[model samples]
Target chain A: MATLMDRVITSKAAVLEGSRAIAEAVRLCRPQVISAYPITPQTHVVEALAQMVADGALKAEFVNVESEHSAASVVLGASATGARVYTASSSQGIALMSEVLFNIAGLRLPVVLTCANRALSSPLNIWNDQQDSLSVRDAGWVQLYVEDNQEAVDTHLQAYAIAEDRRVLLPTMVCADGFLLTHTYEPVIVPTQEEVDAFLPPYRPQHYLTPDKPLTMGAFADPEYYMESRYLLDRALERSQAVIEDAAQRFNRAFGRHYGGLLDTLHMEGARTAVVAMGSVVATLRDVVSGLRDDGHAVGLVKVRSFRPFPKDALRSALRDVDRVLVLERALSPGGVGILAAEVRAVLQGQPRQPAVSAFVAGLGGRDIPVETLQALIARAQDEAVEQGFADLKAELVEEGDEDES
Target chain B: MKTRVEPAPELLSPGHTACRGCGLLVAARLALQAAGPRVIVANATGCLEITTSKFPQSSWNVPWIHSLFENTAAVASGVEAALKALGRQAEARVIAQAGDGGTADIGLQSLSGMLERGHDVLYICYDNEAYMNTGIQRSSLTPLGARTSTTPPGALSWGEVRTKKDMPAIAAAHGIPYVATASIAYPPDLVKKVKRALGIRGPKYLQVHSSCPLGWGHDSSLSIRVARLAVQTGLYPLYEVINGQLTNVKRLSYRSPVAAYLKPQRRFEHLFKPGGEALLAQVQALANANAAKYGFPPVTEGAEAEDSD
Candidate 1:
């Protein structure tokens, strides 16, 4: 019930669920239109924003759509009309929105979305995993993964800045681990409206749907022009890397907190073994790496923040001196290797003194990746040639052929 | 002095790829003429979108967007929200449009959401019966006894056995402010309904029966005649359901036989085959029921009736 001025003057940290943190950041960004469908893990984010709109706390239109497909479409339309828009979904919802996700990016709308990342359904599990957002890796959106609640908040504010930059002008998805980040309550410093307004200006799209200047969008391109259009989209995403770094630096200048450009590293100073990961699992990796460094094991952690632009150069340089790089990931290609690990290997391939890049899939379908498993993985990387395997598989818990439960 | 009817400002330019007698384009042109230049259109992926706005060559003189096939209504909701947020709602009206497939089948849920939310937008469905843009696949709106690529008649089966989905009734069920049915044959009526829908504040739906020369296997020049025959036959009735109440029904002065409507199109050519009598009679019975339901004139003997076959 505090006034805007009172909150600005008393800018203090408050304990909040990660979803509420995202909602608070969205409110500060002043999205003119917010649309979303209630899905597991991501529901609370939109629920909070909906309550804020109802209570006159946020002056935005909260469009309650039928499904995630419509939710994404609503935001895409809103964005094309020169309005700052926000939406959120997870897991199956993201899968349902795959078509529209590609359409939004192809149309070059600077809409921002939050993915409360969850495992895809086969067994219909509603647990935390990075598979959903990572599944739409080639949707041409700037995908940023957050490690914790505060980072989730900061990354959202940064997302709007990064997406709306004229040079970028592509949709951005801020992926935070479902249940891990979305359900857990953590102390987060919510920025004031004035500060957010200063950091992120009003969205002024170069091309938009306005009667004053009639324009056509989402027109189908023939083969003659389709490849060039895709090439341009790729260039735009690649250009987004500089904008992402610049936004991070400016965010640090304004808020005095930093999420390193592209990828952030910890304890990589002259370390022989490095563990690469993303999302909330990186927080666990940080703890395990610090312990190993204290014990003089020469282990480090490379937290990949930007997954879409792939942070290929930043990762290559970060893992250049390492003797071995263990790529731990929460998502995999099912028939292939870890999604992030494969990309890491491709980026580090044929480099001078290329480090050994190993793929390790862990914490899938919301399985807890505790410090013991992290330590075991590091030990395996040190002793054996760990190519690509599940990190925390329970052999005794498996009943072979149980998957065919028909 | 002759009263001059100034032609509706051409919002849709000519250099597009729609067929020679595309009933959908005719309906769109008339509706857009009524909605005028001060409108932003959210179009679904269909014949209208594909033909009019091929990349780098758009026929639209108004601001327009074509997203996926099934999300036009939801997209228009976003456009309306954005306009409302920008305080430009008064300057530009919003229209979401799609083919019957996009409206009655794939896009129904999003359409329902847009209507339920009461966004101040007009959703227009150009009902050409089947998925004409996708090489004549059967859609939910494909009428009974008509043939499509997916619903082709064979030795054991009749084509498209299911009745067309009642989309206007579905729109009216949401308790929206307005829901109407129009035809390209009735240009003035279609234009009037479009303008009226745009003048209203909340969600409105207008389903225009647009005949497809290609899909229907009718002569391109007889497109309007075929559309008119549809209305006269009462198979595709022209009416309005306002605020959930049946308000207006365009009465047929000269009621035509269902055969007069169906016999010309190759899609229904099977109905004239040697063993196709019973299904043809069923088609007539449908028309009779529609006429009875909408209070149209009864089928008088020899009145607008074509060949006995």
Candidate 2:
């Protein structure tokens, strides 16, 4: 046991739910603290982790906190003391954890939270959506959205590596769509302890609170020094792109799983129309675009994985060949256009040649969007591309009197 | 066994910007000094954090962190959990310190969560009553008939009409291993409680009745004197509950009249006026009830009101 702390277990491809795969990835990381509250979609991930600890498969302190706020705080405190920690939450749970999320990132603690993406409440719904995490895009956390269970598992391993990287030192949120990915069972590779040990080394906290070496963290900053601290944090996050990319590269080389940098692409070369989306929707778009290609339509798919850093240059380069870009967003900014579409447009700005971006908002509050809907969005983008497009809005759900006619 | 002042160097050194004679820092000094250098303080955003650690300079000689106003207890829980995870629980101690507002009100949920989780953390609430860091706003711990910026005296209302929330009792209700109340006027006892709480392996609570000269409307030099009166009047009892049992009590010699304690602070100055007499009587009734609850053996009555300053 002393000769490396842990001997690697050879990874096995087994059918597992996305939540269980995330839990398995966390077990490999050897988190010292696991504090989480039960929220739909997110509940399974933490429950599986708790069972692992209970079964002695994972040796860690599993603290079942009362609420998301305390769960976040428990990890924040533990991380400050140089402990590798993990927590899971979603939707209202994530919203409740928002304050601590900012604190964790601000303190530059390398904590990781598995966010099983769910929609926010009232009229209270518990289904999958990206709005929960997307709403906190500016909270200074490294947000990595994945395509499927395999990618979700892979990203969880990478999240720990990148977050604990000395250059990055930022909290990471591994986002996998609720119900769609979290509940759906799929084949996943569980890396051996030896392989994980070789890929991601033991967490050596860059900064920590220790009694022997006394230092003050989270000190009060007056007008003179406040902005500089935030400026430094911003710079650190800005530099994390290289660290994230490097970690992904090293993981691919070691484990035979490739996550192409901050953003991934498919057939953007010589294409006139590209469908852009994040999380599981990106996978759906990929298959839909592939079928459309055989039908003589010039189409491609842009899979946005890193939503926090926004991957501006990667996104700009990927969409350069496309003429009409259909941005499929599962979340709407309410009174504004599509969340992902707005971001894609903003990042694509000032590039020499940019595509005409069309925004489509659907799949909200776990509403199903079938293949026909994707085909409809493609046709709309190819013909009359426009921003702020609503797909499958269920027009009859709204009474004619719901809107006041002038 | 009585706790004597042990030989030790100053932990909370001079040059701090705390209002001169403010007992909050004195309580902090005694507690930190007692814990020695083997402790890390997870402080909430209040007087202690705001006064010390202004960027490049820090008065702390021990590892300390200030995460947020309401989450210090939870932060300390994390620290303690981490130490345990690293097989270093015995190498260091974790303490969460916050002001009254952070303890009894806005921060209560986090503090309660920490205690319930049974984290090996020593949580100290420096009770200076109202939100002193935010200019003496009303807090749940603020005593009845005390003036504050939010609960100011008026023609229709007496300041802070609700009785003070029993924070130590609330902590004891968590069924933690240790819960205690101490006061800055008695440094030896407060320091002893801090030491005793640290010796325990599970969650511990030490609510020190720290005094704020600015917020309490008292002369800065009389901070300790006022703290002593609070205990003497039975408004703030010095006692300890170990393993869900009241194990120790620093019995008062004689129940001091509440008026003697109230008259010195401007926050209670309204009671000195004609219309404030009835409110003062109610405050006195509260002290009497507290005395009966603790049931301390009464001794000498009316001691001389010595003006130490």
Candidate 3:
């Protein structure tokens, strides 16, 4: 007779189903509290876990909060009291919870959140993109982007380890492409329960409510103290990159899976041309790299994983050898260049012999980016670098009349 | 030492920077006394948060946290939840305190959420009628015809045109276990309400009329006297709502006219000046209506223990 754990494992191998993989990963982490609200695309992640809790597959306290703000607050409260807490939201849900998001980080609560990247609403489009997470880039969270279902599951498991590390007791966001990574089905290899238990330990709050050792978690800081409080938070965030790298390295050794660093470089060896991107687009870029390589083009791809500490040194190293680098951003920074483009440029400033970095602001508001378009962008950047040297390149829309005349 | 049932220890100590005779200080001290030492206060960004906690200093003897401008209820809810999870629920009581601006305007949503979720927490709103910290800006709870930084007395307008927000009624609408309005002038009643709220099972809201001298433009020494005048005039009536039903109104003896409350504060001075008698009359009418609705019996001179069913 098989045991209960075996009975639940109908499909033994790792499945690459989008939201299910995320749910499975969270289950592996075994969070004590899960507070969530229903938001489009992101709802399935929490809903699946809720069902698991009800079905006795996951033993957890699933708090059905009324709004996104309360959901974040519930998790913060639960996490502060030393319970491992998890929550998921998207788009306006994130915006609604923005005030508490800063408090959670400022208080240094190690809560793990999953953001199903979606567009902020005015016309209310609930689909896929990076606008939501990028908008809160200054919120002092360790942001990690996942390329696929496997990474989504793996990253969430790793997020807990990194976030709860004594040196980096801060909140983290596991950002996945909405619908693309949330709804799509794929094969994912889930680790055994015993293996996961060994990989990630139980949460132990550094400064929780204890009668034996009384301490204040969040206190009012006046002008003289407020600046130092913020400075400490900034220092903690800057120190998280090393913690993330160490956790990822340990996770790889234990599970036999390797994710490079805060920034991951791909096919950049001896390449003078590259396209820098994040999230699901990295998979598309990998395909583009293969197509370009088959056509005898020296092109590579760079994927940013840790977005908060930003991995400036790693990015500089990745782009140092490349003569031309094209940046693809899925979110706009309004009147300025795209958020990622601005950050990459800031990192490259005054560096020794930098690449001619060009920006392609595409796939915004859930707009799909085909492999063909990504290839064309790479080709355009190479041509622009050859013609304009190190001059900045903007997206050039192809005129319809010109194509018709041709 | 005087023998008394109340603990003599000062939970909210002296040397704090509340204005002379500031009713908020008295209310805070009495409420903290009633709550005792094992209390965790979640203070919102307001006058209390500013004056009590000024960089490497704190007036509270109990553990406290000062969250953002709003969401003290939410933060308090978290503290309660944390305590419950840690199996130390009985060790301390969670109390969220904020000003009228933070409570009635910006924090209503979070407060509602806390009450609806049935968290074991007590929220206190120190109602000084305006945003005292941001230089006395008009807030939702600021009474009508009061001159504030935002609602100035101009040629076209007398002062604030809108009446004070009915916060206790709104809180009662949340179906909380206990909801009450108390004045700093009635310290014993305020302390009793605080003790009652702490014993409740679910969320409780106490709206205390804490007089602000700077915002009201009153003589600093007359803050408590002004607060007492408000209750005597029936402008700021003391009442309690239990389980969504009105009960136990502290009807004063010898109910004074609205002028007794209006004359002392410069914020309400505009209502008494030239062509402002209409606004004053409107304020009087509102006070009468409140007294009648809450069954506030007119107090007679030297008469005590007035009660009506």
Candidate 4:
């Protein structure tokens, strides 16, 4: 029998759900505390984690919190005590934990959370949408959107290294699209125990809640001091961009696979128009862009991996010379524009050659953004002026609001 | 010549922003004193957290953390889990604490989770009746006929109509090993309970009846007096429920009328007003019911003025 202290990792390629892949990767990281409440799409991840602990496959505390609020809180507390801790949630679960999300980042606890991105409820959709994580874009967590199960598994590894770095002690959210990534089965290569251990070292925190070295955490800041504390947190997140890149490089060195630093791109070179998006939809965009490039069209794809710390400089350089930038997003700002589109425009504003940024909202509330829809949207972006609207909207279904006039 | 008295170093330092004669502070000091040096406190956002940790200054000598208002128990669960993970559970102890609102109301779920999961944590609730820190708002644990900002006595209502939520019973229902009630009025008893709660292995609860002079409408000097009166009046029983059984009770030798516990506090002043006789009797009946339930003596004629101690 393997003792409690034994750390074991078995690397293999298996057809697994994104949730199972994430759980497997998390086990490789060997987090000391895993706390989560069951939410649809995000349930399988926590369930697998619970099973791992139950079966003695993982040496960790699987705290069965009553709600997602406590799930986040439990991990936050565990992280403050200098333990590598993890928790996962989706949609309303993420919304319920919104307060503690800011608390975790503000306190600079290196908690890595998996946000199985799902739509917010009114109609109560349980499928994929990036709105949940996007809504809290200003909450100070390092948000990394993964394009596939392999990337989701890989990002979890990079998330810990970036978050636990003393220079950038911020919580990280590895966002994989709900249902699309979390529920879909795909071939994922699990990193070996040796590879994970080499890539990410044991968490050695500079400041932690320990009796041996007593200190205070999460102190109440008055007006005079609160801004500066926030400033420090903001700066730490800003500084994390470099650490993200470094972790990715190191991850590639260790595992022979690399997800980009902050932002990743495909065929952006010498392209007149480019599609910029996040999450698994980026993979769909990649295929569309590849097909267009083969048909002798100047089109490319910009996969925004890091949504927070907004990758301003990388984005500026990527879209500097492009004539038209199609910002396809799964989240919207209701009255305004696509959440990622607004950021993309803001990032490219002062560049030497600014692109005409067009906002396109897609895949909201688990709505499908099929390959034909992407082709149609790309053709429209190439032909039309800079615009913002639902890319795949059935015009007949949307009311023109003649009632207001009546 | 004056001889200087040397005391053990305080785990909770004296300098902070707690109200003068604040019973929560007193309870915190006693609990920390009992738990000794090797402890980590996960305090919920309340008077204790605000007063002790005002950014650049902190009153906690031991490792302390203050998360959000309703997640202290969950945070303590994490701290305890981490300690266990590090194999330092023997050396370090975890304590989670919150005020009445943070404990009995908003924080109940997390506290239940911590207790149900059997984390080796000592969860303490400093029940000061109302949300004293937030301008005396009513919490679920606020007693009947008490006037908080939210439950002010008026033509439409007398005050808080509901009885105090039995939080200790709720904790005991989790099948935890120990669930005890203590009071800031009795230092020896409070400290003993804290120490005993810490000595146990699994989750233990110690709810300390703390007074808020500002919120309760009493002089700061009467904080301890009011707290003691609560126990003596049987409005707040000092007892322990261990392993689902009523194991210990600090039986009152002589009891006071519930009015004695109520009249001094501004919160319960409405109960003593004209046309408040029926409500007063109801309050007294609740206290009598507590005495009956906790194995304390029923009040007799002329016994209403005597002290328990």
lDDT of 2 by residue, A299-369 (tens): 88878888877788888888887788988888879888778888899988888887788888878899888
Query: What's the ranking of the predictions by lDDT, best on top?
Result: 1, 4, 2, 3
Model 3, C-alpha of A308: deviation from truth (Å): 1.4
Q: Quick one: best lDDT, which candidate? A: 1
* List of clashing residue pairs for candidate 3: A14-A188, A14-A189, A15-A187, A15-A188, A16-A186, A16-A187, A16-A188, A17-A186, B253-B299, B254-B299
Off by over 4 Å in 1: A1-11, A399-406, B1-5, B305-309
Give the per-residue lDDT digits (tens) of candidate 3, residues A1-406: 1000111223655556698889999999998888888998898899899999999998777777678887888787667666888999999999999888988999898989999999887768998878899888888899999887877888998999989999989899999999989999887778888989999998877776543444555666767788899899899988998988898889878876766659777678867898888999888888788688778898887889888879988889888888888888887776676688888889989988778877777776677788877777788888764211112222255333222110
C-alpha RMSD of candidate 3: 5.3
After best superposition, candidate 2 residue A99: deviation in angstroms? 0.7
> Which residue ranges in model 4 land beyond 4 Å of their true spot?
A1-12, A401-406, B1-7, B298-308
- DockQ score of the complex predicted as candidate 1: 0.82
**What are the TM-scores, per candidate, against the unseen true structure?**
0.96, 0.95, 0.91, 0.95
lDDT at B141, model 2: 93
Could you tell me which residue pairs clash in candidate 1? none
On a 0 to 1 TM-score scale, where does candidate 1 land against the true structure? Answer: 0.96
Taking chain B only, the TM-score of every model is: 0.96, 0.95, 0.93, 0.95
Q: Candidate 4's residue-wise lDDT over A257-334, tens digit each? A: 776888888888888998999989877887788899999989978888998888998888878778998888798788
The worst-scoring run of ten residues by lDDT in candidate 4 chain A lies at A1-10
Query: What is the DockQ of the complex in model 4?
Result: 0.76
* Comparison by lDDT, 2 against 4, better one: 4
CA lDDT of each prediction against the hidden true structure: 0.89, 0.86, 0.81, 0.88
